[model samples]
Target: MVAGVLEVDPAEVTDESGPETIPTWTSLRHLQLVVTLEEVYGLSFAFEEIRDVRSVGALRDVLRAKGTVPA
Candidate 1:
C-alpha cells in the first residue's frame, strides 16, 4: 500500500521507506498515502500523529496503537 501510493514497486518499499528516502514521495503523494491508509485501516490520523509517522514501521506502530492492525 505504501509502495502503491508512492507509485513504486512493493519490492522497493521497506520499513524505512518514507519521503526522506523515496524521491517519489512528494507532499501530494504523502497526502494520498495518508488517505489510503486511513481508508484501508478504517482509522483517522491526527495531524501531529501523521507528522510523527516517518516510515512504514512508524505507520504500522500508529495503526497498531489504534487497534487497526494487530501487534
Candidate 2:
C-alpha cells in the first residue's frame, strides 16, 4: 500500500520497511500521501499527525494506534 502511494513497485519496498529509500516521499508528495493514507485506512489524520509521520512504518504505527488498519 505504501508502494502504491509512492508510485513505486512494491517489490522495491525494503524488508525492514523503512521510508528513507522511498524516492517518492519528498515534501511535495506529503499531502497526496496523507490523503491517500486517509482513504486507504478510512481515517483522517490531523495536521499535527501528518506533520509527525515521516516514514511508512510511522504511518502504519499511526493507523495502528487509531485502530484503523485491519489486523
Candidate 3:
C-alpha cells in the first residue's frame, strides 16, 4: 500500500514498519502518498495533518481517525 502510494516498488516498503520511518520517503513522496491514500481510502487530510504524519504507523493512525482504516 505504501509503495503504491509512493509509486515505488513494493519491496521498498517491505522493511517499513513505523511512522515516517522509511528512509526513501521524502517530502515529495509524502505529497504523492497523501494524495494516493486519500484516493484509495476515500478520505481527505488537511495539510497540517498530512504534514504531521511521520511514519506508516502514523499514517494508519490518521486513517483510523478519519475512519478510513480499521483500528
lDDT of 2: 0.75
**lDDT tens readout by residue for model 1, 1-71:** 88878989988888888888889988788888888989987889999987777888888888888887633
Per-residue CA lDDT of candidate 2, range 1-71, in tens?
A: 66776788888866345456776777767778788878877889998988888877677788888987633
Give the CA lDDT, 0 to 100, for residue 65 in model 1.
84
Write out the backbone clash pairs for model 2: none
Off by over 4 Å in 2: 15-19
- Model 2 residue 25 CA deviation in Å: 1.1
Report the backbone clash tally of model 2.
Answer: 0
Which is better, 1 or 3, measured by lDDT?
1
CA-lDDT, candidates in order:
0.84, 0.75, 0.73
Sort all candidates by TM-score, best to worst.
Answer: 1, 2, 3
Each prediction's RMSD to truth: 1.7, 2.3, 3.1
Model 3, span 1-71: residue lDDT tens: 68765656766554344334565677887888889889878889998998777777778888888977533
Better of 1 and 3 by TM-score: 1
